[model samples]
Target: MSDNSRLLRRLFDERVRDLGLTAAQARLLLSLDHFPDQNQCFHADRLEIEPITLTRIADRMEEAGWLERRSDPADRRARILHLTGKSRDIVDKLQSTVEHLFEDTLRGLSATERDTLGKLLDRIGENLARAREQEPVHG
Candidate 1:
């Protein structure tokens, strides 16, 4: 892994460890928690992960009382992920850490610079997604 990636991963993991969750657990909850006006409806297939892996992660979170899974109203076969009350509480706390981290990580950047950095990161994610979609699956 790149030095910056490894550094950020450890920084994030250490900051949120008190929530009694792993890095992956925090990610799943944070993703769902981020859906403010989107009805908390996320298509599991939209994530870059394999469908089976996503399903397993969702199942694990559900078992951990972090979330609940239900069939999507529009798509009976597709599962919709929702944060449970327990998770909602933790998510609020987690969001605080996320927000603080954002501010701290960019402490050296001005507002405009922070905005530019965010835009660049978004573009990188877009490029990565496009690349993944074009890649062939290997067994």
Candidate 2:
């Protein structure tokens, strides 16, 4: 699974390089598009990355006019992340690229195989989440 993830990430990076984005940057944009108006901390957790790391990627993105971090109305200290018009325009292209990548990757798999694979992956995710919840706090 790790090998497959690395290969898919490499392919995605190659595809997005033409759009002037790194894999991390592209992922941030895609995540925001799908789950819009979330704060930076939410995005960090969703991406399974450190908050500082997300902030760095977001800083670059913000400078590139891809997104904005506006102060949350409900919480003066929290900054809500939002995709800019420029990023929104590119999201459709990015999403299509992802769809094409998945289509190519699953080309030889039969419908049943694909369904089984999906279910198995979902189970793995659930198991991992359950294990995480059961673990003792490090502190």
lDDT score for residue 110 of model 1 = 90
- Best by TM-score, which number? 2
Q: Could you tell me the lDDT of residue 72 within candidate 1?
A: 69
lDDT of 1 by residue, 10-123 (tens): 888998887677776787778787662122235343445566776788788888787887766776776678888888788888889889887877898998998998899999
Across 1-139, the per-residue lDDT of candidate 2 in tens digits comes to 8999999989999999887788888889999998887899889998889999999999988998999999988888889999999888788889989999999999999999999999999999999999999999987
Lowest lDDT 10-mer window, candidate 1?
36-45
The parts of candidate 2 lying over 4 Å away from their true place are none
Cα error, residue 10 of model 1, in Å, equals: 2.0
Candidate that scores best on lDDT = 2
| Model 2: pairs clashing at backbone N, Cα or C within 3 Å | none
Which 10-residue span in candidate 2 carries the lowest summed lDDT? 17-26
lDDT of each: 0.75, 0.91
